[model samples]
Target: MKRLIAWISDLRLAIGLLILIAIASGLGTLVPQQESAELYHRVYDAQPWLGLLNGNAILRLQLDHVYSSSWFLGLLAWLGLSLILCSWRRQWPALQAALRWIDYSSPRQLSKLNLAETLSCSDASQELQRLEDLLSQRGWQVQPHPDRLAARRGASGRVGPLLVHAGLVVLMVGAAWGALAGQRLERFLAPGNELELVNRRGETQLTVALEGFGIERDPAGRPEQFRSQLRLQPGDPNAAVPLPASTETISVNHPLRFQGMTVYQADWALAAIQVQLGQSPILELPLQSFPQLGDQVWGIVLPTRPDGSNPVLLALSSEQGPVTAYSAEAEILGTLVPGGGPAEIAGIPLRIAGVVPASGLLLKRDPGVPLVYAGFAIALAGGALSLIATRQLWAIAEPKQHKLHVAGLCNRNLAAFSRELPALLTELQQG
Candidate 1:
């Protein structure tokens, strides 16, 4: 049991676990996560890089959602346990030892330190007082005795390793918590459409309203930006008194944050277009993708006569532009711009009233984000603390012999401390 605990708490084991977790995270980034099994088969079945990883293999290995996978969570759990154990077994005790002042009975023990200096001086009492004052000014905590004095500085450095371990554990816990309980939602909402925020259990929590959405296109007709104007209401639909709605606009990199949830403008799509045909009621035609025709082309089939006699295909590549009509034989019949007057196609007049655009918003709620940020802050502070060099100085004033013995030791920056010690001795001798 002792051996096992030691091995688990070993620094090497922690480093190995970190490396494994990093590799797993990299793999998670490379693979599209939480997608359907069919998508995995369609994407990787014929790909040379991951061709051998079929749908079954992906599912069996939990590669579809690596962060939430049992193996990855197990690694996190193991690493957290290791950090806790190491902190408990090593860092805590070391910190306690550093905080406690150990009194040396003789100068011999002090002289044996890795960095040590001995000094001889007259007027032992005055020199000892001056040394104590100098050490105090240098932030050393002094412990005085009748025969000797012990002083140490930068003892907080010992606490740094403990905090570092604690921060790592907190970080791992946050990541695990996020992977286990966080929620994500992707939706395409048209203007004036309202959607309720639902949990994994399908329970509505809040309400989201899409006020408007727009896409900015470049000179070459490529999309440059997608923006969504949204409103967030606090409560579910069943609330007795509905909360005030807050409005926000989100663009590509800018996201709206509210009630611990973030709404990102991920994409945009042409939902449908309202068109009037020959004095009939406005027909809302839902657009379908025609990638073979053009990458951004969307179209719908409509009958020319009121009796649904002659079918014609109407296609458009952009929301702002000319919608082309095609005959059953695939020949171009006519072209009509959006909001343009009715144009005759196959002897029936057609008018495009308006285009409906949908905003694709990705909503995410991660409860562990605060914890992760806090852990990073703590880790940075601990790393800064660890850089402080803990230096110690000891002195004995033997008044009867009319001499003072002094020695210094430092855990870091030994050469600088060595030079400072000699200068301090010279000051004591001259004074």
Candidate 2:
């Protein structure tokens, strides 16, 4: 049992686990997560990056949702346990040892340290007092003994490793919590549309109202940027009837943060278009993607007669362009530009009216985001603290022999400490 505990607490084991987790995270980034099974099948069947592994294999291994997978969560749990065990078995004890003073009976004991030096003095008692004063001035915690003195500097450096491990554990816990309970929602909403924020349990928490959506297009008629004007209400959907004063504008790279949720403008699409069919009512037809026709093109099929006969396909690539009318035989019938007069297509007059644009908003709520940010801050502070060298000095003053035996040790930056120690000892001996 002791051996098992030691193995689990080993630094090598922790490093290996961290490397494995990094590799798994990389793989997870490569694979899209939480997509529909049909999308996975269609994507993988078309371009199978991994040979002999299809969508079924991906689903079986839970690779589609890697962060939420049992194996990934288990890895996080194991790493957290390892950090706790390692801190308990090693860092805590080391910190305690660093904080406590270890009195050396003789200067010879201090001489055995990793980086040690000896200093001689003419008047042992007077020199020892001077050295103690100097050490105190330099922020060293001094412990006086009958014949000797033990002084330590940077004792707090020992706590760095502990904080580092603690921060790592906290970060892991935050990530796990986010994977388990965080919410993500992506929706295409038209201007003036409102939706209630719902959790995984389908409980409405808040209301999001879209005031306006606009798409900035390039000279080539391609969308360069998409922006959404939004208003957030505190209560449920019904409570937002009068609208709220809390409004925010979100663009492509910029997002709006409210409460614990973030709203990102992800994409844009053509929602619907108004069309008039020969003295008939102006029909608002919802457009659907027709990738087979052209890129970024949307189309709709409308019947010429009220009896639903002679269906014709109307396709448009952009809102600014001409809409091509196609006959039932896949032949071009006529073209009508936006706001242009009615054109004859299969003996029916058609006119292209206005187009409605929709904005794609991605909402995310991660309860653990604050914890994760805090953990990272603590880790950075600990890393900076670890850079400081913990140094200790022991001195034995033999007044009868008129000799002071001084020895010094440093855990890190020994060369600099070595030069500084001699200079300090020389100053004390001269005084």
Candidate 3:
């Protein structure tokens, strides 16, 4: 068990784990994931090896969803466990050793130490008091040691390991939660389409109504801007309605939040529909015979008159289609019908109906947002604190000779400490 613990504490194992994490992160960036199996097949057609990772094996097991994978989760759990154990095994003993004080009887032992400074004083008590005061003034929290006036400070430094470990664990937990519980859904509308928010887990629990959509163009005739205005509503329309004043609007970058749901501006399309009114000979109505055509022009049939006459016909076509009369302007006498001119196309009426426009929307919901943010904040703080602050102080005293010694040490950025030690020693000497 001791050997096992020691092996786990080895820096090499930690480095290997780091390498694996790097590979996973690299794979996540290289491969497109979080999409359906068909999309994966499309993306990885050239790399047959990747085909093995498709379907439910990738999705259900979360290999494609790397951040949420069980293996990734297990890796994080192991990392946390290792960090806690290593801290207890290594830092705890080191900290205890630092806290322990020994009466220095021989100068040889004191000289063997790193950064030892011995000063002879007539009144050791007054010097010790002044030294304590100086250390306290310099932001060092002083504590007495066993043998003599061993002023230990910066005890909070011990928490650095725990802080880093906790931060990493929280960060991993937050990422996992987001991968499992957050979602993105897209809906298309012309100018008036509505939809509900869907989470990563494939659940829709909130709805949003699109109030308006705006489009803008640039000098080059490309789409420079797309904006959408939306209002949030309770998914259940029959429930006690919320105040109308509470409705919020959202656009592309600006997302509207309601009841833990968010609605974004995703995309849109135009739909062209034909309208018509009744009866003509099967040959007379080109549209009645064919519902959909390679050419999009459609003919509408309307209600017949009191007399046994042909009904109104409205032919509608998109910008792509060009309309032509069967005869020259002078010869085309009476294909024209009602609202404006003569009505004699087999005694029928004809007119153009206005075009209609529709709109599109996107929705999202993330229950783990707060957790993710908290984890990031903690990790960032730990990184900053670990780099800037560390603990190192030592003191030695003998009861017989009433002489005292003190020193400081650090594992990193030693040059800065070495430079600062002279000044620190000067302050101690003045006492």
Candidate 4:
């Protein structure tokens, strides 16, 4: 058991696991993952070799669905295990050493350490106390030993690896949670239409009503902006509360958020006509609602009598007379003739005027977003401190014959340290 633990705790194992994770995660971003049957078929049709990629064995192994595949999750699990084991074994000793008080006694031993400072001070204790005070003032906890002073500072270095590990765990957990549980829904609404967004599970819901939508354009007529006026309501249909009007409007690049859900302007599309039928005409009618192409609506208009015995209506010019139509439907419409045909337009009992194009909006809700944000914040802060803020110490003391010994150490930026150390030592000696 001890040998097994030791082998697993090796840095090589941890590094290998990390490399494997990076490779797998990179592949996740590179490949088009399993989405739907049609998308899979489309991909295979586009790249015929894609079918061979998932040989029957590989398909069952779930390589196509890499992100959520058991092997991928298992790789992540192994990564987590490797981090915990390696940190526990390697960092445990350094953490103990950093936490323990340093013993700074034995003048002879200190002199041999290449940093010994022999001071000409009549009051050694006072100078030592001052040094201790200075170090403490600079955020280092200090302790005095029998022959000399002992201090162990920056013990927090011990926590750096642990912090990074914790952040990785939190980040991974948050991302996995989001992948499994985050909800996204898209809706298209005209100027006055209302929409209710449903979650992936279809359990939770939210409603948004569009008050208006418009496009802004530059002086040259190219579109410069698009905007939407919306109302957000929370809770069930009956007990919902509407948000303030000022909060309802969202423009390009601006999004609306309410109850932890965000709504963004996605796209827009033109609206179409709706049609209905009534009980009594024997005549055949042409398509009343024409499909619009660009901004224009075009269609063929043919006319027939209600009894179907009349010839089709065609526009023809008479000799210097107004354009005449040679069908009974047009002639019938001239007089107050009654016909048994559709009572209303489309299936609705009313005629539809031109429609205002609808604007599509995307709504997204994620509960683990806060955790991911916190993890990123922690990683950034830790990384910045590790890269920028560093510890340094310069010591100078004069011994016999006006000779002074100076020693210095810096925790980071060694090149800067080397340049500054000589200047500091020279200044100390001259002073």
RMSD in Å for all candidates = 3.3, 3.0, 9.3, 10.3
Relative to the unseen true structure, what is the Cα RMSD of model 4? Answer: 10.3
Of the two candidates 2 and 4, the one with more favorable TM-score, higher being better, is 2
Q: How accurate is candidate 1 locally (lDDT)?
A: 0.85
Model 1 misplacement above 4 A: 198-204, 217-222, 236-239, 275-282, 290-318, 321-354, 399-403, 426-431
Model 4 over residues 228-291: C-alpha lDDT tens digits?
8887655453445743333388876888877888888876544332222233223322222222
Task: Give me the displacement of residue 6 in model 4, in angstroms.
Answer: 5.3
For candidate 3, write residues 366-402 as lDDT tens digits. 7778777787777677666566545465555554566
**Candidate 2 accuracy as lDDT:** 0.85
After superposing candidate 4 on the true structure, give the runs of residues whose Cα lies further than 4 Å from its correct spot.
1-35, 48-72, 111-130, 133-140, 151-158, 198-204, 215-225, 237-247, 271-356, 388-411, 414-431
Greater TM-score among 1 and 3 belongs to 1
- Give the clashing pairs for model 4: 275-346, 275-347, 276-346, 276-347
lDDT of each: 0.85, 0.85, 0.56, 0.54
Tens digit per residue, CA lDDT, model 2, 87-187: 99999999998887888887677668765555555678877888889989988899988778999888778889999988888888899899999988888
Ranking by TM-score: 2, 1, 3, 4
- How much is the lDDT of residue 32 in candidate 3? 56
